[model samples]
Target: MTTRHPNAGLERLHRETGWTLRQLAQEINRLGTERGTPVAYQKPSVHQWLNGQLPKESVRPLIIEAFSRKLLRPVTYGEAGFPEPAEESKNPPATVEGLMELGRQDMDPSRRSVLGAGLFSVALTVPGWQDVVGRMEAIKQNPKLRIGQAEVRAVLAMTERLSDLDDDFGGRYARPMAAAFLVNTVSPYLKAESSSETRNSMLSAAAFLCYLTGWMAVDEGAHGRAQQYYVRALELAGASGDHNTYCHVLRGMSVQAANLGHGAPAVRLANAAAEAAPESTPRMRAFMAGQQAHAYALAGERTNARTALREAERAVNQAESQLGTFGGFSSATLAYSTAEVRYALGDTLGSIQSLQDHFRLRDSTDMQRSKLIFSSLLAERQLQVGHLEEACATWNSVLDEYPAIHSGRIDEQMAKIASLLSSYQRNPIARQTSERSRELCLK
Candidate 1:
C-alpha cells in the first residue's frame, strides 16, 4: 500500500484562516458562486483534500481565492500545495508579445468569462520605474514596415474616440472593441520600425490605451482582469521612459485598489505615483493629491488625508485652465474626490454635500456614464441619511438613464435599489422605485 502524505502547505494556510473545515468549505463554495461556477463542497471534501487527496483542477483557484480573501493577502498555488496552472509560464514573454496575447484573450468572447474570473491579488508584484525603464525587448525590423508621427497620431485619435464611447456608454460594450484594436492594430505599430521619438510617442499612446482598457474593465467589475491591463500599462509607460504616463498608470492602480477596499495597497500606490512626479504641473498635482487624500482616508490616516485634500484644493486653485488636463482633473473632479474622502472617513453628510457640488459643477460635456454612477451614489447616501423621498427621487433619475448604459458597476448599483427600498415598500415612491429597479434588472 502506498502512503499518501498530507498537504502541509494547505494545512498551514487552513490554520492561518482560523476557519473550521466546514467554514472553509462554505467560503470556497461562496466564491465559486461569485465566479458563476457554483459548487457544493462540505467539510468532508475539505478534510479529504487536507489529508492528501488533491482537489479537482478547477476547484484549486476557488480554494486559493477563498484563503486570499479571508487572510487579506494573496495565496499562490504553490503556497496552497497545488501545481501551477498549465497556461502560466515560468519565463515571462517580452512586453509586446505578452500584450498581444492578453489582448487576444480579451477580444475573444468565448474566453472573456474565464478571463474575467481571475482573482484580484492584493500582493501582486508591481514593477517600479527603475525596473522597466527602456527595457523593451529587441525586435527584428521588417525593412518595409515603417511607422512615423502620423501613425502615432492616428493611434492617439482612435484612443480618444474610444474614451468618448466609454463615457457615453459603458465599458461592457466598448472593451471588446478596444481589445480588438490593441491586438489587431496597436500591436503591429509597436513592432514597426520607427524613429526613437516616434517610437516613444507610440509607446506612450499605447500605454494610455491600456490604461483606458483597464479602467473599462474596472467599470465591468472584472477587477482581476483590470489589474492585468494596469500592469501592462505600467510596463509600457516605463519602457517608453514617459514619466508622466508612468505616474498616471500608478495612480490608476491606486484607484483600483481603493475601489476594492484594499486601503494599504491603495495608499502605497498613491504615494508611489506622487513621489514619482515631484515636478508635475499644477493640474497633475491636483490629480495625484486628490487620489492620495481618498486613499489616506481609506487607510484611516485622518491627518494625512486632510493635509492631502488641502493640497489638492490649493493645486487646483493654482491651475490656469483644464485644457489638456491629465485624466480631466478639474474643480468638479476635486469635488468628487472630496466626496470620496469624506465618505471613506465616515462623514456621510459632508460626502453628500460634496457629491451635490460635483453635479453642480458638471458641464454638458461630462460623461453620461459618470453622471449615472455619481447619481446612484448620491441616492444611496440619501437613503443612508433617512431621506427616503429624496433618495427615491435621485434613484429615479438614475433609472431614467440606466437603460441606455451597459456597465457592470451600474448593474450592481441597480441591483441594490430593490433591496435597499424593499423595507419601505409601504411608501408609495419607494415601492414604485423598487418595482422599476426590478423591472430594469430583469431586462
Candidate 2:
C-alpha cells in the first residue's frame, strides 16, 4: 500500500492553532453553524484532513473561518493547505498586461480555468489597497505610437457604450466585447504611450473600463474574477493619480463584499474609500457614505448605519450646489441605500416604502436590471409583511420586463421569489406569479 503522509501545511497550521484534532473538528462545526451551514464533523474528519485528504469545497470556507477565528487574522485557502489561487499583478505594466491577457483568456473556452482557479481572497486585496493611494508618480515616457486625447476619448466612449449594454442585456453578453476591446485596442494604447499627461489620461480611461469589466464580472456571478479586475483597476487608477477613481473602485469592492455577505471587510473597504478621498466632491462623498451605510447595515451596526445614511443625504444635498453634473449617485440610488439600511434594521415597511420611492424616481432606461431587482425586493418585503396581494401586483408589473434582462442577479431574485412563493403556491395569486416566474427563469 502506498503510504499517505500528513499534510505539512495542515500540520503546521494545526500546530499553530494548538488544538487537538477533535477540538478542531468541533470548532469547524461551530463555525459552519454560525455561517448557517450546520456542519457535524467529529475528530475523524479532522484526522482525515490532516492525513492529506481535502475536504468538500463547501467545507473549505468553514475551515478558513475557523482558523481565522483561532488565529485572530484572515486566513486564505492557500494558507490553510488548499491549492494556491492565481495571483493578480502588483504593478502597472504587469496589470495592464494581465488585463489584456485576461481578456483573451476570457474569450477562449479552453482557458476557463483562468477564470475558475480560485476563490476571492480578501486578505490579498484589502491590505494592499491602503498602500495604493497618493503613491502616483509620472509615467515613464515609453513612446511607441503617436497617441493623443482623441484615442483616449475613443476608449471612454466605448466604455460608456458597453455600460449601456450591460445595463440592458447584462454582463454575460457585454463581458466578452469589453474584454476584446481591452485586448485589441486598449492594450496597444497602454503599451504605445505618449507624454506623461496623455499617458495619465489613457491610464485613467483604461482603469475605468477595467472597473466596468469588473462590474460585469459581478453581474455574471464571478466574484473572484471581479475582485482581480477591481485590484487591477485600483493599480491603474493609482498610477494615473486619480484618487477619486481609486475610491470609487474601493467602493465597488465593498459592494462585492457585501453581496457575498462579508460584512466586516465590506465595512473596511467602504471606510477606506471615505478616508482616502477626504477632499472628494460632495457627490463622491454621498456615494462613499451610501456605501458605508450599506456595509454598516449589513454588519448589524444600526446606529452607524443610520448615521451614515443621514450623512449620505446631507452630502447629496450639498452636492446640489456644486459645479458639474453628479453622474454617479442620484436620489434613486440613495433611496436604494436607504431601503437596504431599513431592511437590515428590521423596518420591513420602511424598506418597502423606500424601494417604491426609488422605483418611482429611477428611470428604468438608465438601469433596467437594477430596477427589476429592486422591484423584486419590494415584492418580497411586501410578502414578508403579509401584503400578499400588493406583492403579487408588484411582481406582475414587471413580468414582461423579466424576460429581457440577462443578469444572474435578476435570475437569483426570481428564484428567491419562486422559493418564497412555494409555501403559498396553493393561493391563486401566488400560483400565477410562480408560474410566470418559472417561465421567465426557463427563458
Candidate 3:
C-alpha cells in the first residue's frame, strides 16, 4: 500500500509543533461551530491530527492547504503534495502563470522549473478553471454567444478534466475559469433574442459558474464575499427558471449562512429551495430537501429536522429505487446527507447514526470529496466525546485524502486546531498538528 499520510501530508503537519490529538480535535470541531454550523464540539488539538477519515473529492484541496499552513514547508501533490509553483505554486495550473506571474521576481530555479511543468499541465487540462479577471471583457465581446450548447458542452468537458488535474492546483481554477468563460464567451448572448433553450442554457451555465466563484471564495475563507456571489448566482439562476441551479445556489447560501451561525436564515433558504424546485426531478428534489433538512438541523428542531430528513430520504430512495437516467440530479447522497443535518448541528451522536444511514444509502464513489468532509467532521465528533486514542488512530488512517479535497473553510478549522495546540504544555501531537503551513505565495 502507498500508506498515504492518512490524510495526505496533513498527518504530520503540526507534528513538529507538539500539539495533542484531543486539542486538535477540539479546534477542528470549533471551526464548524464558529461558522454557524450546528456542530458545537470543539475537538482538542490532539484529535486534529488523530481523527480518521479524509475529505471527499469536492473538498480535498480545501482540507489539505488548511493544514498545509501549519507545516514549516508547503506540500503540493506528489512530494509532500503533487506539485507547487515556485511562486503561488499551489494555485491551480490553468491560472498559475497569470496568477503567479503578476508579481514574482525571484524563486528557486528547480522549484520554478517544476512549477512551470505543473502550470502547463493545469492549463491544457483544467482550462475551465481560472481566476475572474477581464470579466467585463467577456461582456464586451459577443453577448449573443452565451451558453451556446456547443460551448456549454466544450467548457463542461474541459471542467470535468480540470476537476481531475490533481490537487496541487486549487479549486479556483474551475469557478473563476468558468466564470470567465460565461462573462467572455456567453454573457453577451443574453442581450440577444433567442430560443428559450438558449436563454436557459446561458443562465444555467452562468449561474453555476457564479456559484462556483462564490464557493471558491468560501473555500478560501472569504465567507462574506462568497455570500454576495452566492446571492447573485441565485438571482441569476432563478431568472432563468432553472430550478436545479436555483436549488444548488440556495444550498450554497445555506452552507455559508449555516457556517456563519444564522440557523433561521439557513432554514428559510433551504425551505425556499425545496418549494421553488418542486418541479425538480427526484434526484434534484431529494437534494433540495436535503439542503432544507440540513438547515432544520442547524436550527435545533430535531423533530422538524427528522421530518424533513425523512422526506429527503424518500426522494433519494425514489431516485435510487429506479434504474434510469436521472438527468444530472442522480446523486443519492445529496438527499441522504440532507437527512443527516443533525450531525452538522453538533449532534455528533446523531450525525454518527445519520452517517451510517447515509453510508448505507451512499453508493457513489463519484463524490470522494463529500465523503471526506462528512467523515472528517464525524471523526472530530468522536474525539470530542473523549475518544482520544480513536481520534489519533483516525487521523493516522484517513487523512491521506486531504490533498484532493479542496476548500478554504477547512483552513480556518486547521488554524483553530493550531491555536488549540499552542495551549498544550509539551504534547508532540499538538506540536505536529500546529506547525506553520507552507504556501505557494506571491512573495
What is candidate 3's lDDT per residue for 42-99, written digit by digit as tens?
3432343234343333233333333433342334544333233344445423221221
Residue 233, model 2, lDDT: 88
Expressed as tens digits, the lDDT of each residue in 162-215 for candidate 1 is 998999889987999999999999989998889999999999999999999999
Candidate 1 displacement at residue 164 in angstroms: 0.2
Give the best candidate by lDDT: 1
* Segments of candidate 2 deviating more than 4 angstroms: 1-43, 50-62, 65-72, 76-93, 109-118, 127-130, 133-144, 321-323
What local lDDT score does residue 423 receive in model 2, on the 0 to 100 scale?
85
Prediction-by-prediction clash tally: 0, 0, 106
Report the Cα lDDT for residue 181, model 2. Answer: 91
- Candidate 2 lDDT for residue 364: 43
Candidate 1, superposed: residue stretches over 4 Å from native: 1-3
After superposing candidate 3, which stretches have Cα over 4 Å from the reference? 1-148, 159-173, 188-196, 321-340, 344-346, 356-364, 403-406, 418-443
Model 1: lDDT equals 0.90
- Model 2 Cα displacement at 414 (Å)? 1.5
